[model samples]
Target: MGGFTLDDILATRKPRDSWWTVFMVDPLACRLALLVANHTSITPNALTRLSMLIGFASAAAFTEGMLVAGAVLFYLSFTVDCMDGKIARLKGTGTPFGLWLDYVGDRVRVVCCAFGWGFGEYTRTGDTDVVLAAVGVVVLDLFRYINGPQLKRVKDATRALLETRLEGQYVLAESVLRSRPRSELEQAAAEFEQTAEDTGATVVDLQKAFHARFPWYDRFRVFLVRHRVRTHVVSGIEFHAAVFVVAPLFGAAALVPVAAVAGTLLLTFEMFLVYRVWLASRQVPRTAAEREKILV
Candidate 1:
């Protein structure tokens, strides 16, 4: 369990993760994590620093219009970024400062790569749209990193409020869906509703509206979860890969359009979650004074 083997290192991964990581990144990262953990006494923060340097090198590659080389370097940079996490989990050397370093490194890499490809392609063709694509990519990344965590916070606060008012543990739809299998999710939702009917438990399903309209969605969710993918298939991770790796393979003209498509897909699914969270929050029972305060 000291990360002497690839599987030992891989056991450190989150229960569910980005599908790209589960499929593409983890395969290479686990082995690398094992190698580094066994040989080097490198701290996670040190690995984070190395990752940022590789990411900057990727940006340099992109600036030179070495499209394939840039793509490869970008992937390698992300591989190192992921490896740091696994190595930390394996060695139990994780720290809050390391988390901060990792987060900052990721944002910086995104910014560098965005402008890297934008200016690189702009130089090649003198098309200003590529620059716009870079701006859009950064905007999307900002919205995700900022709003996503805040949404989770709001959901947690709502759950706290409900459990306080109702005097029983409440099962939230969003939490259950994200963490459980389809059958277990349905059972949990049903049990929550039944408990609410019989006692003081409050039921708030972020998924209620969506599931009612599209009953077949659990099947899709099952398929995605089986692959360690989530309902939001085109997350920021995929957006970055699509922009930096997949689109560039087709050359500069494809870069801007692919970025646009990737950004659109990311926002659409994110908006769906935001709306559902809002809807679910409304179902939380509030005292008249609390409702008045909200209105004020």
Candidate 2:
């Protein structure tokens, strides 16, 4: 599309971590978005706002029991969502406010969509369980917002400690949040690094003590939050694809429940894993020799 090569389109991607995004949805959508960008006056933030509107329309369709229509709208929103990031990177117009707006917009969309599903299901079957499931979906999503920063704090601290040990200096840098801005993230990281430094604690020494105090916490947290398991468990392209594309083939009845069940199962598993990790973390420390052997 336009004169944009695949490599050129890919270069517009902000973060290339999510497997679904990298391998499936984003490339084609981003290519199209880039072409549109070249030919039109549409801006990245404009696409973001458009996606939000599409998301709300998707919810309205779901509320009317038009499952296929809702799904289609959701996909369009998601594609536009992808486009906004590509456009942002392409134009270098990204701002903290835009990122914040995107984050809020996503959460609001999900909640509204869930509510619409529940209300539609209620109209269809009068089953209150589905409504509760909708609530569960909202809770599950909100938990991520609440817990995410703390989890990131732990991860950043661990990373800084490890990198400091390995390299003898600490670098303050931002980790990308899908909907949050890099500039804000860098600001937070800078503050975190300064606090860590001011404590007069060597990053490595503190990390070793922290690890010794909470043995399995780091391992499980890393595995659950940052790896393949996380990608599959947390919805992105997969959830939307399943809801809009696959579920309609079965029936509209499966739409909300499928999303709810998937999210609940993953959230439940994470909760259980956290508890297990916490229990393991409370264990007494191993000796220095044991620690050395384990580290090696």
lDDT, candidates in the order shown: 0.82, 0.63
Per-residue CA lDDT of model 1 for 112-223, tens digit only, reads: 9989988988888898999999999999999988988988987776666676665655666655556455557667777767757756444456566667777787788878
TM-score of each: 0.87, 0.66
TM-score of 1: 0.87
Per-candidate count of clashing residue pairs (backbone under 3 Å): 0, 0
Q: Over the stretch 146-213, how does candidate 2's per-residue lDDT look in tens digits?
A: 66665555444445434534554543231222233332544555556677775443222233333455
Listed per candidate, the RMSD to the true structure in angstroms reads 3.4, 10.3
Cα displacement (Å) at residue 101, model 2: 1.0
- Worst-scoring 10-residue span by lDDT in model 1: 198-207
